[model samples]
Target: MDGTPAAEIVSEVAPRAGETIVTHQRVTGFHASSLDVLLRGAGIDTVIIAGVATNLSVEGTARAASDLGYRTIVVSDGCSAGSEAAHSASLESLGLLAEIATADELLTAVHTPATV
Candidate 1:
């Protein structure tokens, strides 16, 4: 599944319009990815993570982000896992390393423009 199409983002959730999407193959998205360089170039010191495989991808990214000197937050409700139990457990474990919040809370904290 590593080099297959299934490993890529689904067409149903593809980026549209001005949305910027970065795809990474590894568990820790920072390694071997342009994410860290892009973030630094853009002066982005924080990262809000939302993705699948709560225990693996999400956790790995958050940990790597934190280690890379970035403030990382995991949107608990915005992410999904193979099982609800796994999702909840991953959130709990992630809380130790990153700030956990809902999509509503993050939206309230940072307002996005109607058109970007």
Candidate 2:
């Protein structure tokens, strides 16, 4: 599955220079992968999750990250489920464990400078 078409990252969001890419075969990136170790090494305490299968892979990874004591944030508009109902339900449930924000809100927060 490594070199398969489905596994390829689209050009629109391809990794840029100086970006670290971690590949995981498990449902959650943190499982059976160096993602957790890499994050810890980088001293990153926050995680922003966004991907397909809002009720499955997305939710699973977010839950795992939260359980690992990371401040997890899922971008609502950045994920999608099989159905709108499913997506909404997953988002609601995830809200209890993680902060759910729209893509615009996330962008604003990312671009905003931190005040001392």
Candidate 3:
């Protein structure tokens, strides 16, 4: 699995030098990974998640992150499911636990300066 194409991060989103990468083996990224530890170590309280399987891995991770007390956000357009209904349903359910935003909204929020 380590050497397989499926396990590789695509070039577009590949990690740059000095960036930390954590690998997970369960449906939720935090289940058996260093993600929680790494985030806590970095003093991160917010988590933005984007990936495939809107009804499975994405939802699972979002729920786990929310339950862990992190402010979670799911990029709606950045995730996909086997069908539109499934994706919509997942997002609807996740809305109760996490914030849902489109890629554009996320980018704008990231770029907008915070005012004190």
Candidate 4:
């Protein structure tokens, strides 16, 4: 989630179990303190991103993840946008700059490990 409202919604629908949910105040980047702390603490090397506003929060986080030297994967099908053009453009951009895959592909990669 990008902000408190979205985070609240996610919490209402499915409370975060052991995973940490970091809320960024703006879309400038993914330099959130909570996120950095969580990722480092959890020893997370790869970030599989999926969420609404594909061109906004999702892209921001993916790009930041890349900058942070983490293996970033954008789940194309698991994300959406207000318009098809925006969504498609976001996917294309991420594919060109980072790893792009569907949710199933990510699952398989995680499960098999060698397939990645």
Candidate 5:
């Protein structure tokens, strides 16, 4: 995503079809044009986020997603942090703002819908 060239950070996770990769220009927000357009055009109602730098990118996008009225879910285990303290802090904050769940929990919830 970074114009500097797709670094190992991204190369390590090769995207499959039907997935769009948008690079963030900065840490303050989702300032990338491609990201905004793709998200909006795709009609993404919810964002199940999982990535590195838990206290940075993950947190930033999570906040932005919540503000955009998306049902955001942070996968606690799927994300990593520079430190355990930072990781825990990010999870706590996300729990206050969005639905924080484990990978297995999310998978189960997605596969099974609740009855009215």
Candidate 6:
């Protein structure tokens, strides 16, 4: 399988029309990739991460974002792994480092008026 080409992203999870795709071979999205630069170039100070393998890439990316001085938010329910236990456990660990929020809660917060 050494020569086997890496599997490409499937259509279902593919980037949409206007969304750019950033591919990386590392477990972490920020490792040896332009993701951070691309995001910063777009003036994105806050990152909402969601993808497969919650305990691996997603968690790594979220931690990297946090270390990079970004307001990182990992969409708890938006991520998945091989098992529910792993997913929950990873999120638990991730919550200690970054904010863990549901899609609904994030949407509500975005729409809610600021008290200030």
TM for every model, in the order presented, reads 0.80, 0.94, 0.96, 0.79, 0.82, 0.84
TM-score, predicted candidate 3 vs. hidden true structure = 0.96
Looking at model 6, which ten-residue stretch has the lowest summed lDDT?
A: 1-10
Can you give the lDDT of residue 3 in candidate 4?
Answer: 46
RMSD (Å) of each candidate, 1 decimal = 4.3, 1.2, 0.9, 3.2, 2.6, 2.9
Tens digit per residue, CA lDDT, model 4, 5-45: 73465545464577554557776236654786677788988
Candidate 5 versus truth, CA RMSD in Å, comes to 2.6
Q: Report the C-alpha displacement of residue 13, candidate 2, in angstroms.
A: 0.8
Candidate 1 residue pairs in clash (backbone atoms < 3 Å): none
* Per-candidate count of clashing residue pairs (backbone under 3 Å): 0, 0, 0, 0, 0, 0
Go through the candidates in order and give each one's C-alpha lDDT.
Answer: 0.88, 0.95, 0.96, 0.80, 0.81, 0.90
The Cα error of candidate 2 at residue 11, in Å, is 0.6
On the 0 to 100 scale, the lDDT of residue 22 in model 1 is 68
lDDT of 5 by residue, 9-109 (tens): 56567888777666666752465546656777888788888987899988988888888787889999999899999999989988888899999998899
lDDT of 6 by residue, 60-104 (tens): 999999999999899988999999999999999999889999999
After best superposition, candidate 4 residue 49: deviation in angstroms?
A: 0.3
Q: State the lDDT at 20 in candidate 3.
A: 95
Which candidate number maximizes TM-score?
3
Better of 1 and 3 by TM-score: 3
Off by over 4 Å in 3: none
Better of 2 and 6 by lDDT: 2
lDDT over C-alpha atoms for residue 78 of model 2:
97
